[model samples]
Target: MSDDHENQYHYTPTLWIGILFLVLFSISGILHILEALYTRLWFLLPTVVLANIGEIIGWSGRVWSSQNVFANTPFLIQICSTIIAPTPLLAANFVILGEVIRRLGQKYSRLSAKAYTFVFLACDIIALIVQAAGGGVASSADTDGKDPSSGGHIMLGGIVFQLVAISVYMLLATEFVLRYLKDRPVRPALVAAVGPRTLDTRMRLMLFGLGLSTLAIFIRSIYRVVELADGWDGRVISTERYFDWLDGGMITLATFTVNIFHPGLLLGRGNRWFGKHIDASGTSSRSGTFAEDATVVEPKRDNGPGAKV
Candidate 1:
């Protein structure tokens, strides 16, 4: 295709939508950084901040592309940033699950809480690397006037890998939910030792926010898989409407969702840094940091009647 022809429809990203996303991401990123600082949630700081930064850069690239669609620099920036942005957010989600399991009790989980965090985090890192590499290769191909199919295929591979990892995580989460429901009744001795335990309002909100963000990311991932299936020149890839709704809209919503219901707010200060350390005697240790022990304690709350911890 001629340069103009190639740039005509496929290159035309909506200017206003790009600006909107840029503003949204910028505001959200700043808020997340502020929250992280205020809450002292060091564990969550890096991922949340980095993910928001990626969104900001990605949307900035989109805005740049809207101005000059034929420019390779803006195009590459948008592709790389947008593809990699959600990976860290997904990592944050995985990390929080570990804390959730820790607060509830490791016995309720199939894998240890620490394992849940690291395993999925490793997968997320791999996915990020693969996608970044693919974007690099694709950009090089485009610049060199070579067919971009190889790079597109590589990107697709990364996306598929991410999808699989996310699917497994969803299954694991579902299993934990089922297990929690099935094992609702506390053992008499355990109750006697620790007093009655129940899920606090904050904890419930955290879980709900996590689920909503996960679903949003999941939907965005599925959309990417479909969009990239036909390679660079695919119908879906050329359609800005799909990009608006699936790519920009879904991710923006996910980021905002997490920001509004941030772990710092829900889990409370110092809670994210520590885990509930239970010994062989079934006694729980509320003291100790994550580096010192593999346990996480539930945030202290007043136990009301009929509450389930």
Candidate 2:
């Protein structure tokens, strides 16, 4: 380690915090993979797994940083990883909310269920690209022993855009829920998935988990904005404690919450699109795994008005 190496960080990245996030994300990731396979939610694996992978790599960088605080390589790794880690997770959230709107009633939603995923994911990708560019610039600046404020500003702007997108999504979700409550217009097909009224309880529980995860992500975004607002040397950015609590803590909470109450755990088997079979009774199969070569047959729609739970 050269003594003249530019120190990119204000403080040594905490060893315990890095280990904690790494362990937590690993656990969450493994559990989610098992749940997804059991529930046959292959489509969700890319985004959800990517988020966990990013967190793992990012935290590993921090652990390395603790060993060599002045290392630019690890600094770059952590910067890029932390900034972009949540984007894929946010994509997963968008898809979950989309499914919620679909099951509840598309009439109550401002946009069609599929449209929400398409639109939000596109925007999420754009934000990710901008943040990636910013990270590159910041890393280059740090290596040059120059001001990284421009890169910081770029990253901050990208994060702010993300926050705005999340805010809009929250508003639309609230509107959809409110409209559903007022109109009482749930899809008739959602009547009975297994027992008489298990569908409603399961859907509501999944929605609750989605909501909590989104809120945690929103809060984490705000923390990042504040941390970067003052540039590379900002007080908030300097504080390891703030990073642990606001940054790592929030992501850990969101990941675990979403996984514990995963839609796959509840709604996956019921949705034919999730890669499982649905029966005429609108009930999910007792057990099954999705195979790449297997084809899914959509169950016939039961149009009859069944009583809601």
Candidate 3:
């Protein structure tokens, strides 16, 4: 476990991947900021931007490292990026779970959404701090890769905590879907819009996608814990380059996919922000229409021959 070994894990990304991720981050940052301002959920905005910034720096470091394998700056940048990447994921989870809870209604859920948000976010914060501190301590240690004091244990603990939080989220999501499916109430309005079977199919797809996102994050957390368990001496731990692809690249792709197929944004024509308000009788002054009363109407169920059961 010499400095040479740690330094050997250098990577240089091709320009396209780096550029694409940068753009993705920029957009993500803007959305988070807009939400913060419009909705007053401010604490989440900087975390989104900072996470992406850290990632960009890490990618830049890789580009630099390609020029000089032993470059300390790039190594530092990449390590710091790894340390901070999960924060944004956690933040997205917070927002997503909250919206899901509100849409599904709090009374139907087994766990209080607010309480779950607080607990998961608290754990996420503690994990971030621990990982950040461990990265600092480990990176500062000698070439032998030995920080007998706190680095290894601290990093491992952080990963464990992250895994725990992610697990709880997945469980909650699964429970939510199960309860919804079991107690599903057919709304004539939904049937009229898309036909009953099609509407059910769409609902199932949306729930599945939401569930898959939670699982993807869980998988990423597990990979990290395994990667860190060996304390830089184990094969997996020493192979930082592999972790970059499997953990970093794959997880980013997963998250991007999650957003792309997001139920709130893609499933319906209306604004997701006002989805929960749909049933309210509040009227729009201009259109004289109830805010949430708009309905979807399907095509005629019978042909000109008028076939009927």
Q: After the best TM-score superposition of candidate 2, give how far the Cα of residue 176 lies from its true spot, in angstroms.
A: 0.5
Model 2 CA deviation exceeding 4 Å by range: 1-6, 184-199, 274-309
Candidate maximizing TM-score: 1
Over 4 Å off, model 3: 1-44, 47-49, 142-149, 184-206, 262-309
What would the per-residue lDDT of candidate 3 be over residues 1-309, giving only the tens digit for each residue? Answer: 235444545234444555555566556556545554655444444554456566666666666666666656566666567656766666666655654554554433555555556677888889889888876776676334555336656777887888887877777766665544444323323222222212245555666666665666677777777766755556775564566566666556545544455444434423333223334576322211221222232223222254553
The true-versus-predicted C-alpha distance at residue 240 of model 3, in Å, is 5.9
The predicted structure with the larger lDDT, 1 or 3, is: 1
Tens digits of per-residue lDDT for model 2, 142-163: 6776776788788888999999
- Give the TM-score (vs. native) of candidate 1: 0.85
Residue by residue across 232-296, what tens digits does model 1's lDDT show? 77798889888889988888888888899898788766434556444789765565333223445
Least well predicted 10-residue stretch by lDDT in candidate 2: 288-297
For model 1 the local lDDT of residue 34 reads 85
Order the numbered candidates by TM-score, best leading. 1, 2, 3
